[model samples]
Target: MPRLPRADRAADAALLAGLTVADPQAAAAFVRRFQGAVYGLALSITRDPGLAEDVSQEAFVKAWRAASTYDVRRASVLTWLLTITRNTAIDAVRSRRPVPMGAELLDQLIEDSLRSPDLAESAVHRLETERAIAHLHHLSPDQARAVVLAVIGGCTAAEVSQREHIPLGTAKTRIRDGLRRLRAAYAGGDLEVDHG
Candidate 1:
Protein backbone atom coordinates (compact mmCIF):
# COMPACT_ATOMS: atom_id res chain seq x y z
CA MET A 1 0.00 0.00 0.00
CA PRO A 2 1.17 3.53 -0.69
CA ARG A 3 2.10 5.66 2.31
CA LEU A 4 0.04 8.68 3.31
CA PRO A 5 1.92 11.95 2.88
CA ARG A 6 2.54 14.38 5.74
CA ALA A 7 -0.72 16.29 5.27
CA ASP A 8 -2.79 13.11 5.39
CA ARG A 9 -0.82 12.00 8.45
CA ALA A 10 -1.60 15.25 10.28
CA ALA A 11 -5.24 14.84 9.35
CA ASP A 12 -5.16 11.35 10.78
CA ALA A 13 -3.65 12.61 14.02
CA ALA A 14 -6.45 15.14 14.30
CA LEU A 15 -9.01 12.47 13.55
CA LEU A 16 -7.63 10.18 16.23
CA ALA A 17 -7.60 12.99 18.76
CA GLY A 18 -11.20 13.75 17.92
CA LEU A 19 -12.07 10.10 18.33
CA THR A 20 -10.38 10.06 21.70
CA VAL A 21 -12.78 12.81 22.73
CA ALA A 22 -15.66 10.39 21.91
CA ASP A 23 -17.20 12.17 18.96
CA PRO A 24 -20.33 10.18 18.09
CA GLN A 25 -19.10 9.22 14.63
CA ALA A 26 -15.39 9.62 15.16
CA ALA A 27 -14.81 5.99 16.04
CA ALA A 28 -16.47 4.85 12.84
CA ALA A 29 -14.43 7.29 10.80
CA PHE A 30 -11.22 6.25 12.50
CA VAL A 31 -11.91 2.59 11.81
CA ARG A 32 -12.82 3.34 8.21
CA ARG A 33 -9.58 5.22 7.73
CA PHE A 34 -7.23 2.69 9.26
CA GLN A 35 -8.96 -0.68 9.20
CA GLY A 36 -7.45 -1.78 5.91
CA ALA A 37 -3.88 -1.04 6.92
CA VAL A 38 -4.40 -2.54 10.35
CA TYR A 39 -5.95 -5.71 8.98
CA GLY A 40 -3.35 -6.01 6.26
CA LEU A 41 -0.51 -5.83 8.76
CA ALA A 42 -2.21 -8.29 11.09
CA LEU A 43 -2.89 -10.70 8.24
CA SER A 44 0.70 -10.40 7.09
CA ILE A 45 1.98 -11.28 10.53
CA THR A 46 -0.60 -13.80 11.77
CA ARG A 47 -1.39 -15.46 8.41
CA ASP A 48 -4.89 -16.19 9.64
CA PRO A 49 -7.90 -14.02 8.90
CA GLY A 50 -9.59 -14.71 12.21
CA LEU A 51 -6.40 -14.18 14.13
CA ALA A 52 -5.69 -11.06 12.13
CA GLU A 53 -9.11 -9.67 13.00
CA ASP A 54 -8.53 -10.37 16.67
CA VAL A 55 -5.06 -8.85 16.58
CA SER A 56 -6.32 -5.82 14.68
CA GLN A 57 -8.97 -5.22 17.32
CA GLU A 58 -6.42 -5.64 20.06
CA ALA A 59 -4.01 -3.24 18.35
CA PHE A 60 -6.70 -0.60 18.03
CA VAL A 61 -7.58 -1.06 21.68
CA LYS A 62 -3.97 -0.59 22.64
CA ALA A 63 -3.72 2.45 20.39
CA TRP A 64 -6.74 3.96 22.07
CA ARG A 65 -5.18 3.37 25.49
CA ALA A 66 -1.95 5.00 24.39
CA ALA A 67 -3.60 7.84 22.49
CA SER A 68 -2.53 10.52 24.92
CA THR A 69 1.11 9.55 24.40
CA TYR A 70 0.98 9.58 20.63
CA ASP A 71 3.66 11.94 19.41
CA VAL A 72 3.33 13.00 15.80
CA ARG A 73 6.88 14.30 15.99
CA ARG A 74 8.25 10.80 16.52
CA ALA A 75 6.24 8.66 14.08
CA SER A 76 3.15 8.80 11.90
CA VAL A 77 -0.05 7.29 13.28
CA LEU A 78 0.09 4.39 10.84
CA THR A 79 3.65 3.63 11.76
CA TRP A 80 2.83 3.73 15.44
CA LEU A 81 -0.22 1.52 15.02
CA LEU A 82 1.60 -0.96 12.87
CA THR A 83 4.43 -1.05 15.34
CA ILE A 84 1.92 -2.04 17.98
CA THR A 85 0.37 -4.63 15.67
CA ARG A 86 3.72 -6.09 14.75
CA ASN A 87 4.85 -6.30 18.34
CA THR A 88 1.58 -7.87 19.37
CA ALA A 89 1.79 -10.43 16.59
CA ILE A 90 5.37 -11.21 17.49
CA ASP A 91 4.31 -11.66 21.07
CA ALA A 92 1.51 -13.94 20.00
CA VAL A 93 3.90 -16.05 17.98
CA ARG A 94 6.36 -16.23 20.84
CA SER A 95 3.70 -17.19 23.32
CA ARG A 96 2.90 -20.35 21.43
CA ARG A 97 4.83 -23.39 22.50
CA PRO A 98 7.62 -24.50 20.22
CA VAL A 99 6.37 -27.22 17.97
CA PRO A 100 8.30 -29.94 16.23
CA MET A 101 10.37 -28.64 13.31
CA GLY A 102 8.60 -30.53 10.57
CA ALA A 103 5.40 -28.83 9.45
CA GLU A 104 5.77 -25.37 10.91
CA LEU A 105 9.40 -24.86 9.99
CA LEU A 106 8.82 -26.31 6.56
CA ASP A 107 5.87 -24.00 5.99
CA GLN A 108 7.92 -21.00 7.12
CA LEU A 109 10.79 -22.02 4.85
CA ILE A 110 8.43 -22.32 1.91
CA GLU A 111 6.90 -18.97 2.71
CA ASP A 112 10.30 -17.31 2.91
CA SER A 113 11.37 -18.91 -0.37
CA LEU A 114 8.20 -17.74 -2.12
CA ARG A 115 8.62 -14.27 -0.67
CA SER A 116 12.14 -13.99 -2.08
CA PRO A 117 12.52 -16.24 -5.09
CA ASP A 118 16.28 -16.24 -5.38
CA LEU A 119 19.34 -15.93 -3.17
CA ALA A 120 20.33 -12.80 -5.09
CA GLU A 121 17.07 -11.07 -4.27
CA SER A 122 17.32 -12.02 -0.63
CA ALA A 123 20.96 -10.94 -0.58
CA VAL A 124 20.08 -7.58 -2.05
CA HIS A 125 17.42 -7.00 0.59
CA ARG A 126 19.85 -8.02 3.33
CA LEU A 127 22.55 -5.78 1.84
CA GLU A 128 20.22 -2.80 1.78
CA THR A 129 19.14 -3.41 5.39
CA GLU A 130 22.79 -3.74 6.39
CA ARG A 131 23.67 -0.52 4.61
CA ALA A 132 20.93 1.29 6.50
CA ILE A 133 22.26 -0.20 9.71
CA ALA A 134 25.76 0.86 8.78
CA HIS A 135 24.56 4.44 8.62
CA LEU A 136 23.64 4.04 12.30
CA HIS A 137 27.22 3.05 12.96
CA HIS A 138 28.34 6.42 11.71
CA LEU A 139 26.88 7.86 14.91
CA SER A 140 28.87 8.02 18.14
CA PRO A 141 29.19 4.56 19.64
CA ASP A 142 26.72 5.26 22.46
CA GLN A 143 24.26 6.82 20.06
CA ALA A 144 24.66 3.94 17.65
CA ARG A 145 24.17 1.46 20.44
CA ALA A 146 21.00 3.17 21.63
CA VAL A 147 19.61 3.42 18.11
CA VAL A 148 20.44 -0.22 17.50
CA LEU A 149 18.66 -1.29 20.66
CA ALA A 150 15.59 0.84 20.01
CA VAL A 151 15.25 0.47 16.24
CA ILE A 152 16.75 -2.94 15.59
CA GLY A 153 15.92 -4.69 18.82
CA GLY A 154 12.58 -2.95 19.19
CA CYS A 155 13.35 -1.74 22.73
CA THR A 156 12.16 1.61 24.02
CA ALA A 157 14.82 4.23 24.68
CA ALA A 158 14.41 3.73 28.40
CA GLU A 159 14.92 0.02 27.93
CA VAL A 160 17.97 0.71 25.79
CA SER A 161 19.52 2.92 28.47
CA GLN A 162 18.70 0.40 31.16
CA ARG A 163 20.21 -2.40 29.12
CA GLU A 164 23.25 -0.26 28.36
CA HIS A 165 23.61 1.07 31.92
CA ILE A 166 23.24 4.69 30.83
CA PRO A 167 21.06 7.63 31.86
CA LEU A 168 17.67 8.10 30.26
CA GLY A 169 18.52 11.51 28.81
CA THR A 170 21.71 10.11 27.34
CA ALA A 171 19.78 7.33 25.73
CA LYS A 172 17.28 9.79 24.27
CA THR A 173 20.08 11.99 22.95
CA ARG A 174 21.84 9.05 21.38
CA ILE A 175 18.70 7.78 19.72
CA ARG A 176 17.78 11.26 18.49
CA ASP A 177 21.29 11.91 17.22
CA GLY A 178 21.51 8.54 15.56
CA LEU A 179 18.16 9.03 13.87
CA ARG A 180 19.29 12.47 12.70
CA ARG A 181 22.40 10.99 11.17
CA LEU A 182 20.38 8.26 9.52
CA ARG A 183 18.00 10.78 7.96
CA ALA A 184 20.90 12.88 6.80
CA ALA A 185 22.58 9.87 5.27
CA TYR A 186 19.46 8.98 3.36
CA ALA A 187 18.89 12.56 2.19
CA GLY A 188 22.55 13.05 1.27
CA GLY A 189 22.54 10.08 -1.11
CA ASP A 190 24.87 8.09 1.10
CA LEU A 191 22.20 5.52 1.84
CA GLU A 192 19.63 4.01 -0.49
CA VAL A 193 16.11 4.47 0.78
CA ASP A 194 13.62 1.66 0.36
CA HIS A 195 9.99 2.57 0.71
CA GLY A 196 8.94 -1.03 1.17
Candidate 2:
Protein backbone atom coordinates (compact mmCIF):
# COMPACT_ATOMS: atom_id res chain seq x y z
CA MET A 1 0.00 0.00 0.00
CA PRO A 2 1.25 3.50 -0.80
CA ARG A 3 1.94 5.40 2.39
CA LEU A 4 0.28 8.76 3.14
CA PRO A 5 2.72 11.68 3.35
CA ARG A 6 3.70 12.64 6.93
CA ALA A 7 2.80 16.32 6.36
CA ASP A 8 -0.60 15.38 4.86
CA ARG A 9 -1.28 13.05 7.82
CA ALA A 10 -0.47 15.88 10.25
CA ALA A 11 -2.80 18.25 8.43
CA ASP A 12 -5.57 15.61 8.42
CA ALA A 13 -5.15 15.17 12.15
CA ALA A 14 -5.50 18.94 12.80
CA LEU A 15 -8.49 19.28 10.46
CA LEU A 16 -10.23 16.26 11.99
CA ALA A 17 -9.69 17.67 15.47
CA GLY A 18 -11.19 21.03 14.47
CA LEU A 19 -14.18 19.47 12.68
CA THR A 20 -14.92 17.14 15.61
CA VAL A 21 -15.17 20.16 17.93
CA ALA A 22 -17.10 22.28 15.30
CA ASP A 23 -14.28 24.81 15.19
CA PRO A 24 -14.81 27.51 12.50
CA GLN A 25 -11.03 27.90 11.94
CA ALA A 26 -10.66 24.12 11.45
CA ALA A 27 -13.64 24.08 9.08
CA ALA A 28 -12.13 26.87 6.98
CA ALA A 29 -8.77 25.11 6.92
CA PHE A 30 -10.42 21.85 5.94
CA VAL A 31 -12.31 23.55 3.09
CA ARG A 32 -9.16 25.31 1.92
CA ARG A 33 -7.34 21.97 1.80
CA PHE A 34 -9.98 19.88 0.06
CA GLN A 35 -12.28 22.30 -1.88
CA GLY A 36 -10.65 21.91 -5.31
CA ALA A 37 -10.98 18.12 -5.54
CA VAL A 38 -14.51 18.15 -4.04
CA TYR A 39 -15.73 20.81 -6.49
CA GLY A 40 -14.10 19.00 -9.40
CA LEU A 41 -15.82 15.70 -8.55
CA ALA A 42 -19.20 17.42 -8.17
CA LEU A 43 -18.73 19.37 -11.41
CA SER A 44 -17.79 16.25 -13.36
CA ILE A 45 -20.91 14.44 -12.08
CA THR A 46 -23.46 17.30 -12.40
CA ARG A 47 -21.96 18.70 -15.66
CA ASP A 48 -23.00 22.24 -14.69
CA PRO A 49 -20.74 24.68 -12.85
CA GLY A 50 -23.56 26.30 -10.82
CA LEU A 51 -25.04 22.89 -9.87
CA ALA A 52 -21.55 21.65 -9.06
CA GLU A 53 -21.11 24.61 -6.70
CA ASP A 54 -24.45 23.85 -5.01
CA VAL A 55 -23.58 20.15 -4.71
CA SER A 56 -20.13 21.05 -3.30
CA GLN A 57 -21.67 23.36 -0.70
CA GLU A 58 -24.28 20.74 0.26
CA ALA A 59 -21.55 18.10 0.46
CA PHE A 60 -19.47 20.32 2.77
CA VAL A 61 -22.49 21.11 4.98
CA LYS A 62 -23.28 17.38 5.20
CA ALA A 63 -19.64 16.61 5.97
CA TRP A 64 -19.65 19.22 8.73
CA ARG A 65 -22.89 17.82 10.21
CA ALA A 66 -21.68 14.24 9.93
CA ALA A 67 -18.09 14.91 10.99
CA SER A 68 -18.46 12.92 14.22
CA THR A 69 -19.44 9.84 12.21
CA TYR A 70 -16.23 10.00 10.16
CA ASP A 71 -13.85 7.17 10.86
CA VAL A 72 -10.26 7.14 9.62
CA ARG A 73 -10.42 3.35 9.84
CA ARG A 74 -13.06 3.33 7.09
CA ALA A 75 -11.57 5.87 4.67
CA SER A 76 -9.05 8.69 4.38
CA VAL A 77 -10.57 12.18 4.88
CA LEU A 78 -10.26 13.02 1.16
CA THR A 79 -11.92 9.74 0.09
CA TRP A 80 -14.89 10.34 2.42
CA LEU A 81 -15.25 13.99 1.25
CA LEU A 82 -15.20 12.94 -2.45
CA THR A 83 -17.82 10.26 -1.73
CA ILE A 84 -20.04 12.96 -0.20
CA THR A 85 -19.52 15.25 -3.21
CA ARG A 86 -20.31 12.47 -5.72
CA ASN A 87 -23.51 11.49 -3.91
CA THR A 88 -24.66 15.12 -3.53
CA ALA A 89 -23.97 15.75 -7.21
CA ILE A 90 -25.98 12.65 -8.20
CA ASP A 91 -28.88 13.83 -6.03
CA ALA A 92 -28.76 17.26 -7.72
CA VAL A 93 -29.07 15.62 -11.14
CA ARG A 94 -31.94 13.41 -9.94
CA SER A 95 -33.76 16.45 -8.53
CA ARG A 96 -33.85 17.97 -12.04
CA ARG A 97 -35.55 14.89 -13.60
CA PRO A 98 -39.12 15.09 -14.88
CA VAL A 99 -41.91 15.03 -12.29
CA PRO A 100 -43.61 11.73 -11.46
CA MET A 101 -46.93 10.80 -13.10
CA GLY A 102 -50.17 11.52 -11.21
CA ALA A 103 -52.93 9.08 -10.21
CA GLU A 104 -54.98 9.92 -13.36
CA LEU A 105 -52.02 8.91 -15.50
CA LEU A 106 -51.74 5.69 -13.49
CA ASP A 107 -55.45 4.94 -14.07
CA GLN A 108 -55.12 5.68 -17.80
CA LEU A 109 -52.06 3.41 -17.96
CA ILE A 110 -53.99 0.57 -16.34
CA GLU A 111 -56.90 1.05 -18.76
CA ASP A 112 -54.55 1.03 -21.73
CA SER A 113 -52.83 -2.05 -20.39
CA LEU A 114 -56.16 -3.93 -20.07
CA ARG A 115 -56.91 -3.18 -23.75
CA SER A 116 -53.45 -4.27 -24.93
CA PRO A 117 -52.84 -8.03 -24.89
CA ASP A 118 -49.47 -7.53 -26.64
CA LEU A 119 -48.34 -5.50 -23.64
CA ALA A 120 -48.79 -8.59 -21.48
CA GLU A 121 -46.39 -10.45 -23.81
CA SER A 122 -43.53 -8.08 -22.97
CA ALA A 123 -40.60 -9.55 -21.00
CA VAL A 124 -41.58 -8.22 -17.58
CA HIS A 125 -45.24 -9.08 -18.10
CA ARG A 126 -44.25 -12.54 -19.39
CA LEU A 127 -42.42 -13.14 -16.11
CA GLU A 128 -45.49 -12.00 -14.16
CA THR A 129 -47.66 -14.27 -16.32
CA GLU A 130 -45.36 -17.20 -15.53
CA ARG A 131 -45.64 -16.40 -11.85
CA ALA A 132 -49.44 -16.23 -12.12
CA ILE A 133 -49.46 -19.57 -14.01
CA ALA A 134 -47.37 -21.13 -11.22
CA HIS A 135 -49.90 -19.89 -8.70
CA LEU A 136 -52.65 -21.58 -10.77
CA HIS A 137 -51.26 -24.91 -9.54
CA HIS A 138 -52.62 -24.05 -6.10
CA LEU A 139 -56.15 -24.09 -7.52
CA SER A 140 -58.49 -27.04 -8.08
CA PRO A 141 -58.16 -28.65 -11.52
CA ASP A 142 -61.68 -27.63 -12.53
CA GLN A 143 -61.06 -24.05 -11.41
CA ALA A 144 -57.67 -23.98 -13.11
CA ARG A 145 -59.20 -25.30 -16.34
CA ALA A 146 -61.87 -22.58 -16.23
CA VAL A 147 -59.30 -19.83 -15.69
CA VAL A 148 -57.01 -21.11 -18.47
CA LEU A 149 -59.85 -21.31 -20.94
CA ALA A 150 -61.29 -17.89 -20.10
CA VAL A 151 -58.02 -15.97 -19.52
CA ILE A 152 -55.31 -17.73 -21.54
CA GLY A 153 -57.46 -19.20 -24.29
CA GLY A 154 -59.47 -15.94 -24.44
CA CYS A 155 -62.81 -17.73 -24.28
CA THR A 156 -65.98 -16.21 -22.84
CA ALA A 157 -67.68 -17.95 -19.92
CA ALA A 158 -70.37 -19.34 -22.32
CA GLU A 159 -67.61 -20.81 -24.53
CA VAL A 160 -65.95 -22.28 -21.44
CA SER A 161 -69.35 -23.68 -20.40
CA GLN A 162 -69.85 -25.27 -23.83
CA ARG A 163 -66.30 -26.59 -24.03
CA GLU A 164 -66.30 -28.02 -20.49
CA HIS A 165 -69.83 -29.48 -20.88
CA ILE A 166 -70.92 -27.62 -17.77
CA PRO A 167 -73.74 -25.17 -17.01
CA LEU A 168 -73.04 -21.46 -17.75
CA GLY A 169 -73.27 -20.64 -14.03
CA THR A 170 -70.89 -23.50 -13.18
CA ALA A 171 -68.31 -22.22 -15.71
CA LYS A 172 -68.61 -18.64 -14.39
CA THR A 173 -68.36 -19.89 -10.80
CA ARG A 174 -65.20 -21.91 -11.59
CA ILE A 175 -63.52 -18.93 -13.28
CA ARG A 176 -64.49 -16.53 -10.46
CA ASP A 177 -63.43 -19.00 -7.73
CA GLY A 178 -60.13 -19.71 -9.50
CA LEU A 179 -59.45 -15.98 -9.90
CA ARG A 180 -60.34 -15.30 -6.24
CA ARG A 181 -58.11 -18.18 -5.09
CA LEU A 182 -55.19 -16.88 -7.20
CA ARG A 183 -55.88 -13.38 -5.91
CA ALA A 184 -55.66 -14.77 -2.37
CA ALA A 185 -52.41 -16.52 -3.22
CA TYR A 186 -50.99 -13.13 -4.22
CA ALA A 187 -52.69 -10.79 -1.73
CA GLY A 188 -52.87 -13.19 1.22
CA GLY A 189 -50.48 -16.11 1.68
CA ASP A 190 -50.48 -19.91 1.48
CA LEU A 191 -53.88 -21.55 1.98
CA GLU A 192 -54.76 -25.19 2.64
CA VAL A 193 -57.04 -26.21 -0.24
CA ASP A 194 -58.19 -29.82 0.18
CA HIS A 195 -59.53 -30.63 -3.33
CA GLY A 196 -60.64 -34.11 -2.15
Judging by TM-score against the true structure, name the best candidate: 1
Q: Candidate 1: which stretches are off by over 4 Å?
A: 1-10, 99-196
Instruction: After the best TM-score superposition of candidate 2, give how far the Cα of residue 106 lies from its true spot, in angstroms.
Output: 29
The per-residue C-alpha lDDT of model 1 at residue 120 equals 43
Q: Return the TM-score for each candidate structure.
A: 0.51, 0.45
lDDT of 2 by residue, 104-167 (tens): 4333433432333344244433444455556776677678777766653445788678777999
> What is the alpha-carbon lDDT for the whole of candidate 1?
0.64
Per-structure clash totals for the candidates: 0, 0
Question: 93-189 in candidate 1: lDDT tens per residue?
Answer: 4455353223344345334422323334344334443555566546665666566556534456776677768898888887886687676785564
Itemize residue pairs with steric clashes in candidate 2. Answer: none
Which of the numbered candidates is closest to the native, going by highest lDDT? Answer: 2
Q: How many clashes show up in model 1? A: 0
In model 1, the worst 10-residue window by lDDT is: 109-118
Global lDDT of each model? 0.64, 0.68
